[model samples]
Target: MKALTWQGINELAVKKVPDPHLQNTHDVILRVRRSVACGSDLHLLGGYIPAMEKGDVIGHEFIGDVVETGSGVQKLHVGDRVAVSSFMACGKCWYCKQELYSLCDNANTNPAITEALWGHAAGGCFGYSHAMGGNAGAHAEYIRVPYADGTAFVVPDSVADDRAVFASDAGPTGWMGADRGGVKEGDVVAVWGAGAVGQVAARASELLGASRVIIIDRFPERLALAGQFSEGVETLDYSQVDVDDALREMSGGRGPDVCIEAVGMEAHSEGVQNAYDQVKQQLRLQTDRTTAAREAIYSCRKGGSVFLLGVFGGVVDKFPLGAMMNKGLTVRGAQMHGPRYIPMLLERMARGELRTELFGTHVMPLADAPKGYELFKEKKDGCVRPVFVP
Candidate 1:
């Protein structure tokens, strides 16, 4: 099988690898149809997240056809087109029962690594890292999908592949940000980062009945796309305007009721703090950049909520604990619990409430994944999200 593999820090390649087969009673072998690059993949590409190895396949947001199914798989069979959640969860677990599927106890087969790192393992995600189960990623012709019945959802006939592919990760992840961030009717919501995740987060806020949705980013192209999310959506070019003042003005001098930070560890900011974060990250003193998170916390209204939809692997420096505590704000972060939101998101996609194909700004064959990653990583040619076809 041909798949994209991590060669080294800031390196990727297309190489032939062994094909996958059913590994568990609930597993299924999927012939991947589409897999999109995610912002979080950059962390792996840049060697920010530990436990990644040479030649490891590294993609998780995907849609595919089931090629083989294990005996215990009841809802899926050969030839079914489905979108699989990035997070793997055993449906019978306590966390799964509580709809916090990402915190499932039985998913991460390689638990000791993350358990040692974060005190406990959450769940396994395909192709993320050895710390997240070391499962081969979906950026290939085929992948082994464990817990198929719990993690895979059949794509509705009304939804196209490009649109359904996002339901695998970005859609659910963004929805989680707004849903868990406590977006309410008539609430003013602000989202940091206008990438795919941020775009979706803004749209999710609109769908959740936010009276206004403000998306912040420095890129002109990304901000332009975010502006078209909905009538209630607005975009702020962080390079041109002071985000703090602009958000306060938009929220009637009170700051937004909900703030979502969608940018992850590679988040860029200006000035001395940015330099400090960069040096600390390069020196391995901290594993993430908290610029967006700090800005979100600072910009959120008193008694408001902030949700972190971004992926952060390790400890970060200079988090805004004082403002968060003094303002009586609610702060939460999570890897998306896909099972709890994917079905509803797909239904929304079917109804044309969520249009995500536009996020696939660059489409290419699997053989060209290295170039695609270069374009995506550099944010070159207005690449929002690169979609790779297998």
Candidate 2:
């Protein structure tokens, strides 16, 4: 098997690797059909997330067909086309029973590492990092999926592979952001970062009855695409104006009812704070750039909710706790619970109520994954999300 492997900071390679075999009674081996690079993958590639090692396979968003299943797996079998969740959970766990799959207590093999960093360990995630779970990712020919019954959902025939692939991560993540952000009828929602997650968050806000959706970004192509695909969505070029002032004007002096920060630790910004964050990040004094997060908090309406859909690895400097306290704002965030929302998203896709095919702007073979990553990371040729057909 050939898979993308992390060699060093900003280094990736495609190399031959041993094929995966079922290791647990509930495990299955999946022949990957399609996989895509996620914005979060850049964290690992950029050395933001810790505990990653040389030669670690790195990808989480993917869809595949079951080639073999353990005897304990009853619901899924050979030849079943499935979309595996980015994270793994045991459905019988207490958190799982509460539908908080990302916080499942039984999945993370490296709990001590995460517990030291976050006060608690999250569930195992495919190909994220050693701290999340060292499971091989789907950017390969095949992968071993443990807890197959809980993690792999059979894709409906009506949903094309291109669309179904996103159900594994991006779609469910955005849906969770909107759902948890408490989007309501006629609410005004603002989302930062017009990438896949941001685009989907805006669309999900509309689906959940937000009357107005505003997407913010510096990229013209991404903003244009978001406005085009998500009906009623408006775009704001932060490069041209102060996002806070723009939001104030757009919302008629009141801030957005909900503000979502979809750009994570690597967020870029203008002015002195951006340079400060960059220098601090390079010195390893801070692990995140909080520009978008700060804007989200400051731009949100008083008493409104701010949802964080972006991935953050470590502590940030100069956070706006004062605004959150003074304004009585509600802040919520999570790693997406795929089992909680993948089914609903799939149903929407089946009914043609959701469209994600346009997100796959670049499609390449597995052999060309290195080039795909370069294009995606550099945002070359307007690459939004590059899908690798394995």
- C-alpha positional error of residue 129 in candidate 2 after TM-score superposition, expressed in Å: 0.8
TM-score of each: 0.99, 0.99
Candidate 1 residue lDDT tens string, 117-200 = 899897999999999989999999999999999999999999999899999999999989999999989999999999888888
Q: How far does residue 94 in candidate 2 sit from its true spot (Å)?
A: 0.9
Candidate 1 Cα misplacement greater than 4 A, ranges: none
Number of clashing pairs per prediction, in order: 0, 0
**Which regions in candidate 2 have their CA more than 4 angstroms from the true location?**
none
lDDT scores of the candidates, listed in order: 0.92, 0.92
lDDT of 1 at 168: 97
